[model samples]
Each structure stands twice: as C-alpha cells, then as structure tokens.
Target chain A: MFTNPQYGIFVLISATLLTSVVALLVAVPLGLMAAIFLSEYASRQVRGWLKPILEILAGVPTVVFGYFALLAVTPILRLFVPGLQTFNGLSAGLILGFAILPTIASLSEDAIYAVPQSLRQGAYALGATKRETITNVVLRAGLSGIVASIILGVARAVGETMIVTLAAGQNPTLTLDPRVPIATMTAFMVQVSGGDVAVGTIKYKSLFAVGMTLFLITLVLNIFSFWFVRRFQEKYE
Target chain B: MQTNSPAVGTGTAFYVDNTDYYYGSFQAVRDVTLDIPERKITAFIGPSGCGKSTVLRCFNRLNDLIPSAHIKGRITYRGVDIYDKGVDPIDLRRNIGMVFQKPNPFPKSIYENIAFGARINGYKGDMDELVERSLRAAAIWDEVKDKLKESGLSISGGQQQRLCIARAIAIEPQVLLMDEPCSALDPISTRSVEELMQELKERYTIIIVTHNMQQATRVSDMTAFFNAEPTEKGGKQGYLVEYAPTQTIFNSPQMEATQDYVSGRFG
Candidate 1:
C-alpha cells in the first residue's frame, strides 16, 4: 500500500506530457490527409463506401486495436527494427492514430464542405486546377477546422486507456525512443488499477492525480483548438 | 460585300453562323446567325427563358460544361471556328470572359480577386499595377483602392458586381459577356454599371443579355430581340426575332414580337 509521493507525482506528470506530445505528433498529419481524401479525392460512390469504413475503425473497441498492436504491429516492427520491444510507445501511438483518424477526417470534411461553392467556382474560373483550388482555396479556407480536428484527435489519444495499457509497457522511463517499451499516463492508470494499489490509499490518490493531469492536458488542447478555429473562420463569407 | 465602312468603325468581332443549342433533345436556341462589331455594345433582350443567356453562354462555350447540353453550328472569332476540336475551352474562356447575373466574386482579398486571372495566366509582372489598372477600368478602383486587402464579400452588392467586372477585365480579354449583369443591382448601381459598359465598349467587345428593354435601348448600339414561341407541351420555345441597330429596332422593328415588347404590350 506504500507509495513514494514525489516519484508518483513525477511519473504522472512526465507520462502525461509524453502521451500528449506523441498523440499530437501522430494525429495532425494523418488527420489532414484523411480530410483531403474524404473531401477532395473520394468520389461520391467512394465516399459512400469509405466514410462508413473509417467510422467503423473509430467505433472498434480500443482494446481490439491494442490487441492488434501487440500481436500484429509490434511483430511487424520487430522484423524491420530487429531489437524492437514487444510493448512500445510506437505501436500504441500508431493504434491511437488509427483510432482518431475518423474524428479528424469527419470534422475536417465538414469544415472544407462549409466553404462556399462560389469561392471554389471563382478559383476554377481563374483557370486553377483542382489541386491548386483545393490547396489554395479549400484547404486554406478550412484550415481552422482541420486544426480543431487534430486537437480533438489528440484529446482522444491522451484519454485512451485500454490500448495504451495493452500496447505501451509499465516502465515509467522518460525516454524518447520509439523502439523502447515506454509507459504512458493512461497505461499507468490501468496498470495500478489491477490490484497493485489498495482502494483507499495515497497510491489510489496518485491515480486521480494522473487522471487530473490527463484531463488538464485534453482541456488545454480543446481550448487551443477552439482558438485556432475561431482565428481562421473569419476568412470565408 | 457592300460598300466597306470605315476600318476604324467596322470589323466583325463575333460571327454566329447557323448556331444551334440543345439541352438533351430540348432545343434552347435554333439556327440563329448574326455579327457583332468590334468595340460595340451588343445587347440581347428577351422574355424569361427565351435563350438569350444560352446564346451569350455560347460565346465562351459555357454551355459545354452542362453535360446534357449540345451545340451544332459554327461560331467564329474573327474568322476562326470557336468550336473546333482542338480549341481548349480554358484558353477560349480566358480570351472571352463572362460575368453572371448575380455577383460572383472570390471570397478573397480585393487585390487577390482582381489578380486571380493574371495569376492563373502566370503573369509574374508587377501585380499591383495590373490589379489597379483592371479595377480602374471596371470603375471600382476609386472605391476599393483603400480596402484592396479586404475580403471581396465585405463589399456592397454594387461594388461586388463591379469587383466581378474588374475580375473579368483583369484577364485582358478580347470580349466580355454579361448575362444580365445589372439584374441584381440597384438603380444607381445599374447606372454606374451601364456607364462602365459604355466606356468599356471602346476597348472590349461587349455582349449583354437583359430582360429590361430600357437597358437594351440605353446601353447597346445593336439589339437582338428573342421571343418565346408557344409549344404544345404548355411551355415556350425561344427563337431570335430580330437583330438591327438599336435605334432602328426601337423606331422601326421588323418583327411583331419586338414591337410588342418595346411598346410594353407583352414580353
């Protein structure tokens, strides 16, 4: 039932920081590309097929994604990296990335579609190709929404538990290597919840402290996303 | 063929030879033929859905964009067939700009909106000068110069229409086609746009479609009247009724429909 208060607090803070950064770094680019594919490249028929498939990926239990990360993804990484750890942050981050793809894609698509059709026609009438029109007009016009989607994806990644618990290891080492099995805040919460700490002790209080840190991190991301979207939504009429 | 008029005042800019337009088996315009003089304002006046806009769209082949629409017959630009197989619609549209009835400006800065055509054509010259010159020509420069970086939608309806005019003129087209350009403007804005059209005809060949007979009489030197012939299926089919000098058409129109319309008897 004993817990070192200083080490517990430090572990909680570092894990929260690492998880937030890893989530954000993976989500932004994947989300932007998803938005583009869904809004611009996909035909109506393709969209009808692809959108539901993407949402299903989001709806799938995170534990299943974690299981796939452990059995399928980590093994594949080992073949390439040779010394890759069984439960590493990279696999957990990748699964987390996939889990949040629909969030980013759907929100960003809504933003892009919200841009007035007149602006798009105006661009095309000026002889802009589809690529130029999407990049210069559609994407730029919808950039705020895309940014908001990425932040929401980060929030989803930060709050994730079962996937990180299964894929990311329990060692709270503050290392940046993707090949090493690194612990995240959500993983620690799940690890400690499994009878390793008694119900009414400082060790249990540590869980809420970590939960508070996770909540604060996601809250900041959500606020920053709101600010970013508000700042850019001023362009379109 | 007849005694050639002074070269300064007589050259064909647009020549329509037996042109026909159809919307998927529904004929919108019949075998119509006419000549529009260079640096002249030619107005097409007609009742609602009388193929005036269809003919105007034919100048730039905007009709081709509609999947169900088809065109047969030759439209010539100074002697070259505009509908030739090798003609790129984009290039043709660049040379033949168009403004719609409703104001349609890019949701960008006034400067970028004017510079859009120039940029698309890869004009890397001093964009500031080109933007200013085009806006000045469209008669919107004095009003929008201070707010060059502001969004185009922020402008009033009149200014937005003029901004569209400036956007069209920025490409430095040989001709400007207006499909009811003043239909959405106020009286004062309409007057300003009409005056701008008059000044522009000295440089750009202008074709305008209007339902307003007075607009046709006021701004155009040449007027083409179109009438909707009643069909069996409870709809009207459009055909060209007459084409002549505006004064001649208003004073002594040969077609009964033209006289009826000008006299405000019926559209």
Candidate 2:
C-alpha cells in the first residue's frame, strides 16, 4: 500500500522507540530506588507486606492500565502541559511505567539481595555507612543483575500492547514530544486488526511485517540480556 | 577471676566483661570475660558451634548485623564501652577492621577495592601510596602490584585473602578481627597468612578465630579456649573455658577441658 518501505517503517519504529524510552526514563530511577529500599532498608515485616502490594500492581491487567491512563492520567497531564491531548504518548508511557514497576523493582531487588552478605559485612567492618556499602559494594557487585533487570523492563515496555493501543492514539507521525499523540507498532496493528481490512491487501499484510519487526527487536533485547547475565556469572563465579 | 587468670592483666585493647550474647531467646554464649591486648595477636580456638566466632565478632560489634542477635554486659575498646548507647557502630567499626574467614573483596579493581573504605571514611591522603603500603603490609603487594586495575576476583584465592587484609588495613583501623582467615585456603596460603599476622601484630591488635589448634598456638600471643555444653532442650551453649598465654594454652592448659581439647582427646 505504501510506495516506500522506510516511509512507514521509520516513523512507526521511532514511535515505538519513543514511547519505550519515555517510559523507561520514568521507570529506571524510581524502580531502582524502590528495589534498594526493598532489599537494603526494609525490615522483614515491612518487606513481607510491601512486596505483595507491588506484585498486585504487577498483576493488574494491562487493559485496565490502559483504561486508567486514558481516563485518569491524561487529565493530570493536561493540568501541567497545556498542549497535551486527550490521548497522548506521554500519559500512556508514564502509566505504562507504573505498570512495569514491579517487574523492574522486584528483579532489581533480587539482584541487589543476591550480593553476598560477606561483602556487606566487609564494608560495614571498614566503618562504611549503609549507603556506602549498598552503592559501592552491593550494587556494584550486582551490576549485571540490575542491568539485566532494566533491559528486561525495556523489553516489557516495547512489547506492551493495551496501554499504547488505547491511550497512545494511533497517529504515528514521529515527533520527539511525548505530549503529542503517537502510534506504537503494537497500537497500529491493533488499529488495523480491529477494523475491516481485506485479507489480501497490503494493509493486512503490513500487520505481519510490523509484528515481525517488533518480535525481532524484543528478541534481540532478550538475547542481549541473557548474554550479559552469563558474562556476569563467568566473571563472578 | 583466678589469680593466675590472664584476664587479670591490664591489656586494654578490648576489655570484654561478662559479655553474654543471645540469638533471639537462645543464649549462645555465657559470661565471656577476657582482655585483648594492644599490638598483639589473640586467637580464639574451639570446636564447631562453641560460639568462638560469636565472641570474636563482639570485639568489633559485627554481631550487630544479625537482627535477633543481642548482647548483655560490657565490652570496652580503649576505655569506651562499644555497646554503650552513645556509641555509633559505624565510627566504632572504622577504628576496628575485620577480615572474614573467606576473602570478601568488592567486585571492583584491586586499587578501587583497597581505596573504597578509605574513600568512604573521607581519606584525604595520597591513595596510591596508601594502597601500596597496605598491600605491602599484607605481603601481597609484590604479587598484585602489576595488575592494580584488574578486578579483585581476578587474583588467586590466597592472594584475594591477602587483598582483603589489605583492604581492611587500608582503613587504618586500630584492631583487626579475623574470623578464620585461612580456613578456606591451602597449607601454603595458611602459612603465609599466619606469617602476615606475625608481621601485622606490630601495627594493629589482631583477634582471630580458628578451629585449628596448631594455627592458634603458632600465631597467637594469647589464646582463649571455648567449649560448649548442650542445653537441656538440645541446643549448644558456649562459654569460655580458659584464657592464657599461647605457650601455656598449648603446652600446659589450666582447665581440664582445655587440656582435653588441646591434647585432641575430645573437642
């Protein structure tokens, strides 16, 4: 249906990339801080109670998250950015970040907590503060795990469907501003599939092409993360 | 408190008086009284589960890491009660360093590993010289000096232990507490570590825990022997059986149990 392959592909790819990048910017720092609190600072009783709450957030269906973002979060965004639309990439991404919080936070906690207790003791015995130990020794030691956690979170954000489909609003013109409407590849596929496109048409075939492209991107990310984890093990073990 | 008791002496590096430690409701050690002298190597020798390590950890308050682990009675370091409410464990630990049974190095470059503690303690001195001097003091400098930028885990197990000792000493702590510093190494590494301890005692007070009776006798200036008795409900409770000069503890122990343990008749 399109004369140029790069014409549709570039804009769609950038839209997908932009949405995930915006989401991760919000996710990584907040997720890492929460992971640090869960692993290092929380007492056993507090951890037991707090962790399941995070899991419940993770367990919430993405379609529900899409609805929440479309209805609730966009209004809040509109209050701050006057140019924000009813359906905007910024709101979709921010809410998607919260949707993936438990994935990043819980996995990062596992990484941080997997650092040997002896390392913590060594830091403590040197008269290092708790912050020093966590940042220098524990976090540094668990670097691979933490990076892997982030990469996995990236993969999740890239592959997420319902939030982008509903809230991002399928208008895939590539602008860097997140307050504008955008169409993720996932959202565009949903848009076309939900409508009446004939089976043999290029519009219908473009769905498979887009699906293949997203699959390739996510596959590369997963492979890279696994490779990183293996490299970490080879060094530490 | 017998007349010939070594505890009678005024060796004031640490004065642990009636120090009882508990893990939750279970008392692990009872009525531990000893004085670790300054600039000397003190060894704690006992069988497994005798709480020798628990007692050694009290010297630097390392046992505080355990949530349910609590202690009663007095432990003084240079006239300050380490367990006092006013004492900050962080400041206390800076003055007292530790080497674990297994070498525990930060997963950083050897240079960074040695420099980390000093940096966090706000060391304003030339770090290169300090890292060199600390590694030299630990006797692993000549071996590791060429690869300063390599990860600490890149070294051999024995060299890693010495690096850990270097990291601990780089902080300029006054006392060094080692929990089985050589239990994980080969005979050659163990001997070198023992040699390092001999050299280190001139600079810092060293307290070590070991299950090896020979290791205790060989390296320590004074030795404290611990023995355990099973409580009524099938748990072991450890207590100090004797404290004496290394020579006396090895050659002629005062208590029957100490004699029995050193003679290898029973643990």
Candidate 3:
C-alpha cells in the first residue's frame, strides 16, 4: 500500500500535539497530589515505606504499563463509558500519569524536607499551628522544588512512547476529547515501522521529520526542568 | 572598661524555680533554681555539656520542639508560670526572643529579616518605621541601611548576628537570651555585640550563655556558674554551682568549683 506523504506529515503534527496536551493534562493534578501526600500527609514510617513503593511505580517498564492500560484499564472503562474504543488516549494517559507520579512525589518531598528545621521551629514558636507552619513556611520554602518536579513530570510524559503506542488508538484526529481514540507521535512511528515502506522514500523521510519534532519538544522540556531546579538551589547552610 | 554603671535598679525579672530537663531517660539539667533581674545582663558560664544552653532554651521553652526533651518545674516570666498549660509557647517566645551562637539569618533581604518576627506576631502598623527602629536599636542600621534590599546572608558574620538581634527585638520581647552570641565573632565584632547588649539592657532583661569567661565578666551584671554533677547511675547532669554579682563571682567566688572553673583549674 502506498502511503501519502502529505498524510504522513499531517499525522505527525497532529499526533505530537495531541500527546503533549494529554500528557500535560494528566501530569499536573496527579503529580501535585502525589507531592502533597508524600511531603505533608505521610508519617515518617509511612514515608519510608510509601516512597520506595512509588519509585517502583516509576521504575515499572513502559511495556508493562502499556499491557496494563490495554488489558486492564480499558476493560474497566468499557463498563461506564459505553462505546469507548479498545485503544484510547485516556487509558494510556492515565497509566503514564501513574508512571510519572513518583518523579513528582520524590523530588517534591526532597524540596519540602529541604526547608530549614529552624524556620519551622520559628513558625511554631510564633504560635502557628501545624497546618499554618506547613502552608506558610514549608510550602513557601519548597516552591521552587515543586515547580521543578512538575516540569520534570511533564518532560517524562511527553517523551514516553511504549505505553502510548500500545494503548492510544492510531487515529490522528486533532481533538481535545480524551473519550475519543487518538494517535500520538510515538504510535505513528510504530505504525510506519510495522509496514514495508521502501528505503529512501518520502514515507521513510516523514519519520525523520516526526523524529526531529519530537526531539525538539523533549529537549525544550528538559531545558525547562533544568533551569527551574537551578533557580531554587537551596541556600541554607 | 565599658561603663560598669548599673543603670537599672535590681528588680526580679525571671524566677526559674526547681526546674528539671530530661532528654529521654537522662536528665540534662537537674533541680535548678535562680532569679534574673529586670534591665540587667545575667550570664551563664560553664564548661561544655553543663546545660547552660539547655537551661537557656527552657526560658522560652525552645526545648519543647525536641521530641525527646521533657521539662518539669516552674519558669516564671513577670511572675507568671511559663510552663502552665494555658501558656502558649509561641507567645512566651515572642516575649522572650533568642539569639543563637552561630549567626543565623533568613535567606531573605536584610529588611525582611528584621520584619519577620513582627509580621508573624501580627504587627499591622508602620512596618518601615518598626524595621528601621529595630535595626538602629541593634546598632547595625548605619552599616546596613543602604543595603536593606540585599540578602541577610550577604552581610559580615558580625553584622548577621546583629541582624538576628534586630530580628528578635522587632517583636519587642521583654527578655533576650544569648547562647554564646559572640563565640563565632572576631574581637571587633564581639565588642560591637557587647556594646549593643549594654544598650539593649536598658529596655530588656538579657540572659547570656558564654563559654568565654572574659565575655561574662565584661557584659554581665550577675553571673551563674554551672557545673557537671555525676549521677549514681553513671551519667552526668548540670546544675547551678554558684550565683552572685559579677564582681563577687569573678573576684571572690564562694564555691571551690566556681573558683577552680573560673581560674582555669577545671572544666
């Protein structure tokens, strides 16, 4: 089958943008909640146990997440959202969110912990309650760290490929609706490679264009995360 | 030879009675009792681990934050029991501010450092005037006035300690606790802090803990000597060995331990 060159470029652009938007939407709330839970809610013993468990979540292979998304989450969603497609962005995005939750939680915990003990004591000595101390002192002190973690989570989501390819349907429609099936740039690469496109063809050349766009997107995200962490380098001695 | 003139009449400021401090199973300060006078500087001088700092922390209940630390006994401020269940530790600290041994300034602008305690205590009027007044009172306003916007950490070691003093007094505490406030400073800076202390004593009762015997003799009107007492169970605890006017404590100490310790005979 002859693949149209124009169709390939359009699919690449549509997929990249769709993936980025979905990843960002999922990363923000999940990551922020994870950070708060780990840093503020968890007890020292619970934190000792839960943090490593979260890291295991982050360490789980993308292929395992893809399998979970395809085999597990889709079936669950089918019960409520009737007519939901077998492979959809929602399942993949949710699983990818779980995968990156640890990045947000661990880094944010480090940031919150980095707040000086003296400052916390100072706040408490001023008659501030536990909630007040956490809100006014700990969170304020750790703002830069939290911002850096969110950027890192976003970067991880944007760059993820395996889960998106297996779970997200290879339909390149440029719509914001998570309920509808959509293809991401990573899925397109897998689709193109699965078929027999002759060497040096425009079809083959289209992958390079998609590859370049993905590279730039991930590079920009990486740079952003780096700068954010550097900006808030802990100054307490 | 800074003015040895006793500016304020000797009136009771603090009445720390039968106080005991425990760190888990071990007692750090044992059955201590003493009086601090209003508008005067009282120095606690002792060898290392003699609970001078520990007792100092008790005045403001700063030890409460340490999970293992426990206190029993009465520390009265203006004749009110500080350890009373209704006495808020925060309010107690606000009325009795502290300066640590090492200079610790917030990682903020110099102006904000002085304003932090006041803001926390809900000071709502004349923030600029209050900040300037506190700085001038601490005697660092002239050196740092133009650079109020600069980071507090950017100042010299001596200047940072004074900034801490300003930070403490911004809340207008009735008493100031100094835990070796000059130990980390040079002679020049130490002299400046000593001068500031003398000036501050006119308005606030000052309790200073110093490892330097000369510093205690130079700045305090009264001096308390703490010594380690070995327990039957084989651990050491700290208690007041002697308390007297600085002149008597230094020139004519009543206790052999105080004389031995002060005369460089023993720790």
Please name the candidate that would achieve the greatest DockQ relative to the true structure.
2
User: What TM-score would each prediction reach against the true structure?
Assistant: 0.86, 0.95, 0.86
Interface RMSD of each: 2.6, 1.4, 2.6
Writing each residue's lDDT as its tens digit, candidate 1 over B211-231 gives: 888998899999999888777
DockQ-derived CAPRI band for the predicted complex in model 3: acceptable
Worst 10 residues of 3 chain B by lDDT: B1-10
User: Which regions in candidate 3 have their CA more than 4 angstroms from the true location?
Assistant: A1-4, A7-43, A67-91, A125-128, B1-10, B229-235
Where does model 2 exceed 4 Å of error? Answer: A1-6, A234-237, B1-11
For candidate 1 chain A, the 10 contiguous residues with the lowest summed lDDT are A1-10
- Name the weakest run of 10 consecutive residues (lDDT summed) in model 1 chain B: B1-10
Q: For model 1, which pairs clash?
A: none
True contacts kept of 1: 0.22
Q: How big is the positional error of residue A57 in model 2, measured in Å on the Cα after superposition?
A: 1.3
TM-score of 1: 0.86
Candidate achieving the largest TM-score: 2
Q: Which has the better lDDT: candidate 2, or candidate 3?
A: 2
> Per-residue lDDT tens digits of candidate 1, residues A1-237?
234445555654555456556666666677777778877777789989988887887889988988998999889878888668998877777777788878888888888878776666555555566677788778877777777877787788778887777887777765766667666788777777877677788768878988887788788988898888776664533
Among the numbered candidates, top lDDT falls to 2
- What are the fnat scores of the candidates, in the order listed? 0.22, 0.92, 0.22
